[model samples]
Target chain A: MQVFELIIGKLLPYATLVILIVGLLYRLNRWQRAAVGNIALYPSAATRWRLFGKVLSEVTLFSSFRQENQALWKRTWPFHVSLFLILLGHTRLITDWPLRVGLGLSEGTVNAISAWGGGICGVVALMTCLLLLARRFGIQRVREISTGEDYGVLILLLFILLTGNAMRFFTHYDIAEIQQYFRTLFSTAPTQVPHDPLVLLHFLMVQLLLIYFPFGKFLHVPGVFYSKTLLAKDY
Target chain B: MEGHVQVNETELQTVIDQVKAIKNGPRVLQLYMDICAHCGVCAEQCHVARTMPESRTNPAARSDHIRQLYKRYGSTWGQVLKAIGAARDITEDEVAVWQRDFYECSGCRRCAKFCPFGIDNSILTRKGRAVVHALGKSPFMMSETQRISDETGNDEGQTYAAFVEACRFLCEEVKDDWDIDVEIPIDRKGADILFIPASADLVSFPETHMGVAVFFKALEIHDGTTWTMASTAFDGANFGLFTGDDPHMARKNQAAYDACIDLGVKKLVIGECGHAYRIAKRMGPTASHFGNPFETTNIFLLADEYLQKGVLKFDKRKVDEIITYHDPCNFARSTNVFEEPRRLLSAMTDNFVEMTPNRTENWCCGGGGGLAVMDGAEKVEMIDGTFLDYRMKVGKMKVDQIMATGANYCAAPCANCKRQLMQLMEHYETGVKIGGVFDILGNAIVLEETKVKAGAKVAS
Candidate 1:
């Protein structure tokens, strides 16, 4: 309990910090939506379905990766795959109720999967970040077009993953304490939160990422799905 | 030696110098120079580029050849250094290849329509041809056609006797077929419309010419006249539009306009050549020699207006055969004459199946731009390479749609489209016949109130 209280001392401020950052992201999305309303020329149900299918194929399945320049595709596919897997691994942090209800697994089993997924994601993320950064600076056309924002996104993502995996794999943190902190925030209960420094660092980095995502082409993660799929030539 | 004129070097050089002086005369050239992005999207969209072997898929390869001249003359030192670094140079052999390539294109705006930036590649091709023309390097066929246009007022060099004889023959044929004494008036003053078609229609595409004559006869309207101009401008087929010489372009248009004005016709109805119509309707007004406020309504627009007002009627029972319409790239994309043709087709036929990429998105028949008239074996490489491939791919898709419907006829208004579609049909052996929109209309024209002449039969 004392250890939990100490962890909460460091992490509570970041909860407020995450709230503020998420608020900014919401505002940015709202602003963009207002700015570019109804820009699609041919909006229809069939078009929507086509666009949805295309986005799923492109972003999740990396359908376009197959047709893209081969060397670039190889580096990009692994990075994207790792990032998605890492995101899925983090679902346990948000809601343990799903694991409790669906799997009926003990906390130990859930923790093992999370840790394994997190570690694999971290290794792939670091390697991808390194290779992509090298290629962006090395390739003539890519180098010419890449901005400071591009490098910043790559570096920040690397930091988040590195810190996340280090805390999960290297340090022994109480999963119940982390889950209880999340449950308190969700339920509006003023419970004491985790105070682990590595957890606090991870939360801070994630909040910063949320604040940054809307402002940069990182928004293109969603934007490309809409543009490429929705606007693709029908015939 | 028979119909060809000998090229005088000194005179040709003088003409070239004169053209070079006026090359930068128009704001159009400035607009062209500033607007193009060189994204090669035009080349990518171009059927010629797609169908051409990897060795020659770049349509802009010729334009790039001419771009060297622009870089040499128009660019700053930094630009020159960049061009030099890129190994760009204008040489005689390069010039010769450009001449062949420039002529090989049908000047269809299929590429222009698909370009994200709207870079008017056909216009640039024309401009390049103009530069080549200035250098006395015009292709022999085009130059000969231009010469015939200059001397005989038409490309075919048809005399007034032949012109009248053809008209009379058509009138007699109409009288024999339709049982009507429809007079095709010549040299009548204050006619509502002065109908000027390419001489090709009178001789080669008789069915289309007869369609026009039938259209006029069925309306029982006599306010139109056809004339063979006293000078070389009788044919509206502007070879200069293809070759890119503005003065020669101006000369051809000026002659046509002068004849129209001389006849005191209120409106000039140009026949179904896409570039010819574009030149007459758009470029003619801009050429300084035409003296601005140049007035002409495309014949297609006239047809549309008439059809809308119930001035024209057709018996759809006559056209029971399944048909599809190919929008000539010029009329479809360039001039926005898409809906009217379809409207006409719908009225004329019961089974009008639209090709997949119909209207603005329709593919070129691989023979527009100026490739239709260009005489060279290398043209096969351009057509079979780019135009044919584009048409075939798009055409195969269209052909499949067409085959699914089991349509026997494909109706295209533009002569170039008809010509190209004919070749495609032959190449693919698609077992489909191609003709003009009015050919269908003429076949379907039912004389209800108007009495047919006792002995008249439809002219073939």
Candidate 2:
């Protein structure tokens, strides 16, 4: 158990990082090479520069879906926004002064910000993922179009977020210790790794998500740039 | 499922290979293939999907049929994946149904408007059509038109003599009716503009030809802007774009391109036909096998330029009926020529109203993407074992929109939209008349010189 924990806790994060960087680069390169036709959705080059602005609004706000399917976007936007906040909440691991005191924030203020932001977003994200999963199962139109991949992705994200919130709110997991472990991860070798069973499970789930990121529906993150409609609208 | 129609195994393999084949693939195709989330949001915006929300009618659902085949056979790894049951197999039933669904979709990219990612499923539909075309299974109307286009450089198999005779008749009719002696110049050398109308305009829709004579001669008499009809390569319609085959499309467009070069015209203007202007402007420059020497623009742009310069005039009193514009999907969403025709219509009519969702969001006149030519109710039987006039049934949304406007005339600029609108009006018994923008212009355009400023401001 110790050896397994050490390897998964210490070594697997590095492997996941390599797989993420190399896999994303390789898949993105393939997409960039294959984008040959001009399939611009809009008819004119007159409003071409507005393409990125349009993409930004949709990506950050789910604006298009908001206009069309308010039910879906209601759950989808909060989920994405919460995910973004969770990522911002994680900067304590890499920042020089944990919780970004480089911006001249006080220690007490940083702790309060992290507690409220991470706790609230984590709970909201988990709830929305559940709602998304429920909709995928219940909605006929969504069910007809969705494959097993869609269900699996949502369930997997649910588990990841649930375990993360568990660590944040339920147990007394040492924040400084986890931060130190991640600090070691940024170096050539990691030491004093947290082999806690929940942390190990969380890390393994993350590794799986990372490995599938470039190959799955998440490829949309990279694929949006190759849109013909975007090119027609902008270029 | 038990199959009634026999599946050709060999032909099925050829179809699958083409779907999997990507040649110098524009990254747009691959990205679209890879990235679609199968979200049903695009379905709401699709006229077909909105009307028919069955299993495969959804835009994303329809596209997935082709995407599944491509992914199943894309590479050795994919083949291995298929063998182990990791991915779905490309079956004969899917291929057969895809044939019907892909053809039914008019290749209107309107679904892109509601797609958060802007994934244009029309490109995928075109790819499917190209594969079916390779197997010699394209729709009968499309393939027949392409065959005639390839042999005679026009869809109607028309000759120069017949074209000239038609024009002469139109010139005489214009003089008899309106006392305007506008000449329809045929094969005149060194003309400034090479005007190519759909060949049917000469024989079937001669009013269109009469209108062209009126408008072109007015431009000639007023501004000395020379425009002539080339005796050969006279048709502007390209059925090749409908088939999704590049070589075939190039063949359809070859006549007009060669005519522009042969006639020594300074400007190449594709007259009011929608798909013709789309092909000439969007796909013609690079995809036509040969290149156009001059940049090709639709007549709308030229008309706008002339309208703004105070070179075109209209007597609003003459066009006394209420006019509403129907935007052809190709012009509204595929090419940007929506406002020019409306601008002209406004100049000529005092009672101009807009359809609910005009411009890019305009409803397709069910007869687009060569469906106007298809007339396939006799040939195809629906799954319910009933024969239906496919255009009128699919075009119900647009029919309602047109009737709601309650306009006397619909100023449809594209030939396909005009054809479809006429059928929709007849089928719905809506008492609406559909004609080209120039048809309205011919009725109301004043030949006298003094009213330029009045027409220009009214054009706003």
Give the distance in Å from residue A1's predicted Cα in candidate 1 to where it truly belongs.
Answer: 54
Per-residue lDDT tens digits of candidate 2, residues B15-102? 7767676523667677776778766788778888777778677888888877666667774456643443224676756555766878
Per-candidate interface DockQ score: 0.02, 0.56
**Residue B33 alpha-carbon offset, candidate 2, angstroms:** 1.0
Candidate 2: which stretches are off by over 4 Å? A43-51, A97-99, A186-188, A233-235, B1-7, B75-87, B285-293, B377-388, B449-460
lDDT of 1 by residue, B209-310 (tens): 777767766554423233222233446777776777667788887777777777676667777666677667666642323544335766678778878877
TM-scores, each model vs. reference: 0.59, 0.92
Prediction RMSDs, each to the true structure: 13.5, 4.2
Evaluate candidate 2 and give its CAPRI docking class based on DockQ.
medium
Q: How many residue pairs clash in each candidate?
A: 31, 12
TM-score winner among the candidates? 2
Off by over 4 Å in 1: A1-235, B1-40, B78-80, B83-87, B221-234, B285-295, B378-405, B448-460
User: How does the DockQ of candidate 1 come out?
Assistant: 0.02
Error of 1 at A115 (Å): 28
